[model samples]
Target: MDIAEVLTLADDLIFAKTGKHLDYVQDAILRGTLEDATYTQIAQELYSSPSHVRNVGSDLWKTLSKGLKKNITKNNFRAVLENSKIYNYQSAIVGENVTVGENVTVNHNFNVCPEKARSPKTPQNPEPTAKQPRIDLGDAPEISTFFDRKSELTTLENWILSRTRLITILGLSGIGKTALTLELIPQIQHEFDCIIWRSLRDAPPLASLQTDIIKFLSQQQETNPPNSPLSRGGEEIQPASPRRGEEIQPLSPPLSKGGLGGVIHHLRSQRCLIILDDVQTIFSSQQLAGNYKPGYENYGAFFKQIAESCHNSCIILISWEKPREIAALESHQKNCQTLQLNGLGESAREIFTEKGLSESEKWSELIDLYQGNPLWLNTVAAAIQDLFSGKVSEFLSYDSLVLGDLEYLLNKHFQRLSDSEKQVMSWLANQNKPVEISKKPALLELSPSEFLKAVESLRRRLLIEKVQKGDRTLFAVQRAIAEYLNS
Candidate 1:
């Protein structure tokens, strides 16, 4: 009867009765009730009026009561549900007038009764349930609040289920890349034999990281080692490619060295899900995006090997920048893909509601203004609560954008741009509307090549907007970013 299970069961029952699933407000009310939250607290959390919450809760209880064939009230909801569950479990019938227990018998006779049907032989050894995978979430942050990402989670799950070996999730900071991936784990973790989440923020060398991961994966092999040469102090014998005229590349794995080859051997040994976070840390700052820092160049090779080597495991890289090889790999290999996370759409209204912001109608305007980034919306929502007394209309009345604390975040993104890219951003920031960039503008200081490169780089960083007007492509900077630069 935990909140998740209760909500799921309630939702299913309600759907069965009404032919419709529970709405957001109803879901919120049920969750709030489970936590013993007051109507006032629930109203404030949803930015709803107390009257509306009460009316909805009243109707919801009545619906549940009718559906469950029992009296259901807000105060006694938990007890009613528990009793209903127990009743249903005991009422289930395996056979007519038959009791199920030790040496149970059926009173009714069948027309054809085999020997086993008369006296079923019991199994001497019962099959055990499958064990959960070993998981090590190193330094992974806990998600305090989660917004809806059902579509994103489904897409990621489909990719993993299809046996794609390498996935890189790219997004602007605060766009919920980590949150989305963390949410994805539960949906897809059952497909993996082991799951490991590690952060690359400290820029661990490729060899060291490889060794660390290999050490962890080797344990799965130790517990369930195959009767092959691998565990007999010898090299593994790889299976031959199917005779379908498809060429297969052979691998020469060196288990002794802490290198890509060794990592591939362990990856091939089991179905593991390895997540490397903060991948942008390994790239150099003040340079074009995704250029590796000095002495970190080997990571490019490691990534290439993970994508190219034949293995059953998946490696997910989370970062703010897309690595250079990703595009080429995606075009060349079916198992390699990149997902660039972006701002939310209508779903973002939930953030304002959670922050107790007023004027629900104006939320879309505010979400659009902040580009629908979850963290950015949360940040701006707090600002709206503090400066405008939670009035969205008043915040929008100012016309000009405000970046009270968002400036620091913008600074981080701008600092990563090269000189040419910064110039392009400055130009874009000064423009009042989205501009056509199909042709090089005379106003920009850079040459044609430099301008195009900068524009491409800015697009990759997700710092600029891309729009279409008739037959032309237009680009524009977000109002907040422009305000930051102007300030």
Candidate 2:
């Protein structure tokens, strides 16, 4: 497998089993030339201390070994690599011809031509290799790392099993959207005859993207147009090797239909699932100023087509923020499902306990404080282990437990709010129960209209819950976010 594909698979494996994110050091190690470098060399290259590199390498081996269901070492890392077929190939296109897979071979033999014989040309230089920084992957969570996200997993499974052509998961930043999506890959991968995930993080050129899609799907290179110019910016475009091919056609125009109508034809005929995660960056509205920092233009229409037309295959969109414009397209024919995820449940206790924390005297209070936000729990748990010499139960009683990362975990979400908005939210959080905005507008120093608007925005973001009593509407922050603020 190519380095990119291997790194992607390794990352997915590490993150899926373990709820921990890969540190930058780990990412660098995975992408670096691992064959020749020693731990000390890696440390020097990453500008980190040697001990840190050693630790990262040790941890990475453990994680990979666990994921592969066997022991992993530098000697066996290559063996583990051979056993996996997760991302062996991709998709591509040529003129009107489209293909899927990689490593396509062209059988071409040429005799010396008169034109070639007539001219003497200087030899061209080979492209220079980039000098990549060294890093250690051992510092990241082991592959066996796991979070308690049963509810979110179940929700994703339900949506996948639902007869919906399109399902969208919406939430704010760091809300576990990526984690949740990665977690689901293993569970649902077996259900479909084929499963493909494409990251729209860097929205490439449309033609280039289409080429990649076709290559991954068709498994062969489509014949290019005759005498087509292969050089762009003075660089020659090399032909790609071919793999397996499944014939398909693009869906009919109005193109909101799955952009891969042609591709889905093959998948539907064979039964498959396609996950397009973080597609929000692609579908985000370009009209909004500073909205999506450019390069992503008019992708909403593309997604609308995928949802409306693709039925034989499932297209899942995992995104931080929902495209509000999609609400209009909700119709009988289109099965567009939206799921908003929250924090972990009681199961998180198991996660913490497994991490070596003892039963807490104030179990409920501690859990309530962290609200079982998976990342926060791990961060707090690690901090507790590193700092506290006392038992977990005793540590719970001290303010130090609350003062560490747990406090920031709770406050991070609140800190995202504007000063005026946070003041309003803080007041609501401190309330014994829900209070009508009108009853507390003076407390926040906002006019009635402005207070109402702020409340609505928070509610839409799922930071707060709203209730209606007679003619008045009361707003309260969700118990989780509130606990953070009140903590």
Candidate 3:
């Protein structure tokens, strides 16, 4: 029999014995074993960690061994299933009764012990009528003392509830993009059937991410396909498609037309909230802002499709810099929006209050100097308490801003700037106040187009701000950024 047939039969037999169907990961592991693929290979194809795949494989083998009443392992699973075809036929004939060993008998009636079904049970309560949504916040940083952002949270909720398919949270690092999303989860988790949180820090390939998400959404179905292994006994099984590497390939005509139809299908069928954190990791660091790294260009298409396509799901992309696709798609599409997160403003004073610093007039200037970034304020507040005996005025009397731990933080963001961006930033640093674009000095030796491009790049990178100056637009870097540039 073919591999699909074998997988179908295995699913039925395992369900018959264990009163549970194989999950997508378990099914993939079984198929991989039949195809002579290793855990690493399967994990790569599935966009899952290898250790997670191996754990699922181990549990599947153990369940099958108990169900078949024989030692079933990855090495011998195929042979064992092929040998049991006749027994499977006989078991179907017996109806609710099956012979396990020489004298052992097993019952297949699912209703007799309803509790033994595959569904999980609550500790003190009976089985829930509906499955609880799966929540996976992988490596998301915990926020202990989350200050303000109430209005932002409400805006996010309104967007998600309005069926907005794609939302991008744009901000500088340590500007609370992740914190805002974490805060939003509790308010919106009930709205989605499944809520997943994944970071693009390692920049997994787009295909792998699509496969992983599709698998998770597909597994929410209540029943398996009818053309299962046991039902297709002597039929031909088509070979699995060749694995795609990390490089981008031209999509087949069908896939190109569909634009990830499988993933969209699941999104249409289910309400899922997928939060992709650290999305800036996928962009090329040395290039202009919003440019994708090699082999990652497909991500732009993926995001565009998600934003434009009709689906019940919502995707929240949290990034240090906004992607170019977001700017294009969000402008024309009502269902897509971008939330640019600034610092905490007056609410940030709470950090100083919590740090036991005595409040004074200087507190406002200090907050302004750091742009109200909680991480930066916390570091500065600690410095003030330690070096100035918890006196804010004493610390502010110095001629310059304290660059203590803030230097390390600012250096990280500054190091990623393109040459043009650095030059523009340095020019802005020397300005006494916000300057209009038309009034920029000609000493920089840039044309109007080049100057505007650099300014736009800086805006995307969250390194500069644009403001209205009567009639012309004025741009200036934040105090912290200006300090970094001047230093």
Candidate 4:
């Protein structure tokens, strides 16, 4: 039975006993219980004390027991109601097996107790009190070599604790945005009721992504496992043991039906931490940063709702490009926030030390050249090891940037640029030094306004660097990027 059916049962039973309908707290408790939430989680959601919630639950359960003239308790309430839904049958429980209709079919190795019996887990049985939220870190890479980002971690924690509803960790590929988030999860998972990490690398449509997430967050488990023994039109039904990992508590019903509306309901009711990685894939290439691709524009509305709505949940977006709404909607006291991740500094020496690179004194020069990007440094460090036996000084003697696998990484970013952006990048690559905007080459047929817009776009994309010469603003591409373009 779903939440509504259970609630109707509760109301009918309670009203018959006391001639009073369920109150607000009573209704909230039923919703929380149906979702497999602990009393503490429900209490926190309603800003009420756990003791108070338990007190109300106890009184309510006693009333139910009187109305039914049968044993009814918190753990068994759902089971009793569900069992009542089954068609007329001759049933008996023998140890871990429940037999129906003359023992023609037996559900073996299962928990079939109306009185909280324990064996192989089934929906009717009560599971242990849950302290951890349900987690699904799909395709979220493990942090094998995380460089310290203590400050960033602290900032993210503070924002989440303070109820920031939306956060975007923005940076170029190879930066430690994904790494930092992976590390942060262990430190904060206990604070939420559900935590999920999804990768947008494949750019799954919003509806598909939303549906997948809803299914995970849902209290209702998926359809029968391949081993389920029951089929429709057949009288006998056998509930099988959990096919996956440890058993999940059975939900009375899902708060969400499935879609944007369903998603928002779950977010508002449960404390969820949703991490969306590789968000750039949902955005259009060859355009300014954060413009969603044609079919993906609805993500803007979804993100805006996350930021504008009053909810206790949090959504974290990890991307190479900042979404347009991020700059426009974020405020000092608002729930929306953005973190543009930069490179690791001295902490990055660990990558060199791990790579067995020599000339510790020259490591900083190499790090500075690669802008302390972890993946870029790792790629170059390997080339240095193969070509120069891990000698930093020997590699430096060549005075040429080492971009082995980095070329592929850079090419991925290059492929996403607009024509204006490409022309600006080409111009910057050939420049001898940082030059003022007024000194554009005549051959680069762009007007002043177009040049400035392209430069600004590239800056937001982290493809070009800005410098100050006297009082004039100067811009130039990084050596590795320039070399990639020039090559």
Candidate 5:
């Protein structure tokens, strides 16, 4: 494959497993090695010492091998590449039909390679464009400029293809669950005969959804030109709807109702994909109790019916928390497969590096403080860009991030905890050393029993992790959790 396609594939592979992008060093080393450049030559080209080049090469090999689910070394990495379809990628640069591996071998004149210039890489512009304004809404309020979520996209695609009956993505707010779902749709559109995306915020009544389904199915029939009675063009060619007395129109191609009942009637036979965004807003337990309080509506039965009946169609649920009914579907202790998205990875430095800090140590510290949440990373980056005018050294010397809207976004999630819980968490965060909870109860000003209850609650919620040292179980809030509480 051409070098551009090769880079995209490499990105896809790395992101698919680790949910992180390839850093610049990784990208540069991989490309350099692919072109058969020795460590010394690569060092010269990349402006690094030969030893640094070798270390980067070693790290790249380990990262790629782990991501690709196979062992790979620089010597064998190219062999694997040659065997993969990406190696045969076609490139039409200046009307030259150049197959990546055949026409442009990596050896003798590697520096003159055209693929190096055409690689699909993030630009070196370190700062976010001025057009992207700072926005702060609850959950994912801000648009992250440094998003590198390739693996999550790949995993979503795999879920669409694999034999799994149902796939649910569960995570806390602002974790990029929605962003990841939207990114995967365009890539996997061809896999499904029908792809219907709906936001549950304004979930129509059952009748409206049923009617909408029939209308959608009819449109599909017209496009595919299936031999069904409903397939007829009108004077102005209006979209198809089931014949008034037809009762149930078949859903699949060459549609026939084989007891899938009327709702799915014709649509059940084909491979379909339905994505429900913000499912938590619609699938609440309180809604099913017939209490029409604001957003309460029992969608449990609707979900259960769809899951139990549909065979070829896969239903994707994206929610902040798992709905009870969906969680109960898995028999035994095997819970439904849930992909809990965390934060962006350290590789985001490649993005920051473009704005102009090439040093790894400085970038590592920034990523550590932000924990690599794309939105947060971008926010701090914007502040740094504005404050220092792209001076990486000056930016690192600062004590705190401006945090624009991140503080408010974090407050919403943190406010859900009880007052005592917040207080205990803050205490743990301020402690200079790991405070043994059993003995340090007086320091926290909580009775022994109450302290135990509060600590257990935090652990259950995954806000805190217990560090066991001999007989003492010291408690500390997780970095992200602590940041939210402290903010």
Candidate 6:
């Protein structure tokens, strides 16, 4: 029988037996089984996760098996129904059915029929099957050598496995946001059925991104390849090759409905881990941090839905600054959280040692000067080795911290700040310790609202930090940022 006919008969049998109708996901699983589709294929079609589909299929078979009084599974479900004389039989027992309040029972004499009694029995102990996890890391940088994010990785893993839907990894550029995420994958890959990593380097339009992601989840190729581009910004960067023995299928045509709904459907259906790196690229560069660029405003809604919607998947955003929506959502939502990465502390020494810098009394001083940033320390370590024979004392003998390429990096961050934000940074640079908002009015000559706005802006940009002193909230710039501001 065709799929529709099978569904009709099965639905009737199921409802009669249990007084309940199969849900859409369950019906879809049944249809998929009739078509001989794999669980992954069924999940892709339903925009659900493969593991969820498998569970639904398993429950469906067990229900049918108990109801039909015969072993039924994905492999033999069609055969069992076909061989039961269900099409020609007119009665439940010899053709009679009994009904009770809101429930109907169909009795079939499977014990008398040798063919029905001798059907292949379902395996009680099924062999463990290796699952192939779909990984798509689009344009995420490769980490050649990673270090000292053990604690951070463990925290992130716990968050993901605990069903934290939205997580933001915030840090300065080259502070190992990408490295930490890359290192995090291997640790958490087993928990998820699919892992997707996309970079927002060129700031693609949110709609286009949604379409791309949905297509991937649906396991379909682009229908209008020449007419539609994968990414709206620069040339689309291809994802790396899948691990050996993993099959990487070609992109198929787009889904019928291409937008947030489709994406959410997949998320709800599957256990996926989606990583979006360089998320700051989608924000307006010259405006307040976290404000989306014109066309990308929809991203805020997308993220908000992913955080608020009931879904089993997790999305980790690696950004220089937290998105504005995230800042607001995380305040009220438990599943959404932000992790701000600070300097590597003693871990900075590893970068220096790897670069052949000798240990000295001034090593701690140097590390403190660079705020224990691995990239900053590595850059200065090479300079010290070249200019001072790798002597930490020689590097520390100078009254000022080494600027090197750090100035350029800081410039990129500074250039994105608004005038008010820059003003706050300038004021904080002159202070030795954190200052409270109450004290800013006299020094800045701005209104209370303006002052608070500027401080909030700086906080979002990650150019300043808030510390609690007594009952007051104080703000301070990091040493590296202060040094850059002074220079």
Each candidate: how many clashes?
Answer: 0, 36, 3, 0, 14, 12
The sequence of per-residue lDDT tens digits that candidate 5 reaches over residues 1-487 is: 3544556556555544444444434555777777888888766544445776576577667767765556889788878766543344332211123223423433211112345554444122121111111111222323344367788878777766553446778655666777777677667664444566666656555555545554554454556343222221211212223333433323343323222243444334444566667665543231221122243443565555655553545667777555556645754122135676776777677657656544556777777766666666666677677777766678666464445667776665455555556667888877656667655455566677766766665553345656888987777664545655555
Q: Model 3: which residue pairs collide?
A: 5-229, 8-229, 9-229
Candidate 4: lDDT of 105? 38
Cα error of candidate 2 at position 485, Å = 6.6
Model 1 residue 445 lDDT score: 79
Model 2 alpha-carbon drift over 4 Å, by segment: 1-143, 147-155, 171-176, 200-211, 220-272, 278-297, 329-334, 393-395, 398-403, 406-432, 438-440, 443-453, 466-474, 478-487
What TM-score does prediction 5 earn?
0.52
Q: What is candidate 6's CA lDDT for residue 345?
A: 76
Regarding lDDT, does 2 or 3 come out ahead?
Answer: 3
| Candidate 4 pairs with clashing backbones | none
Q: Which stretches of model 6 miss by more than 4 angstroms?
A: 1-129, 220-254, 470-472
TM-scores for all candidates? Answer: 0.68, 0.51, 0.66, 0.67, 0.52, 0.69
TM-score of model 3 vs. true structure: 0.66
Q: In order, what lDDT does every prediction score?
A: 0.74, 0.53, 0.72, 0.74, 0.54, 0.72
Give the TM-score ranking, best first. 6, 1, 4, 3, 5, 2
Q: Model 2: which ten-residue window has the lowest total lDDT?
A: 106-115
Candidate 5 weakest lDDT stretch, 10 residues: 127-136
Worst 10 residues of 3 by lDDT: 248-257
User: For model 1, how does the per-residue alpha-carbon lDDT over 177-289 read when each residue is reduced to its tens digit?
Assistant: 99999989887875566788999989998878988887776653344343222222122323322334443332223445456767776666456799999999998887877
- Give me the displacement of residue 50 in model 3, in angstroms: 42
Alpha-carbon RMSD, each predicted model: 18.8, 21.2, 15.5, 13.6, 17.9, 14.3
Q: Name the lDDT of candidate 1.
A: 0.74
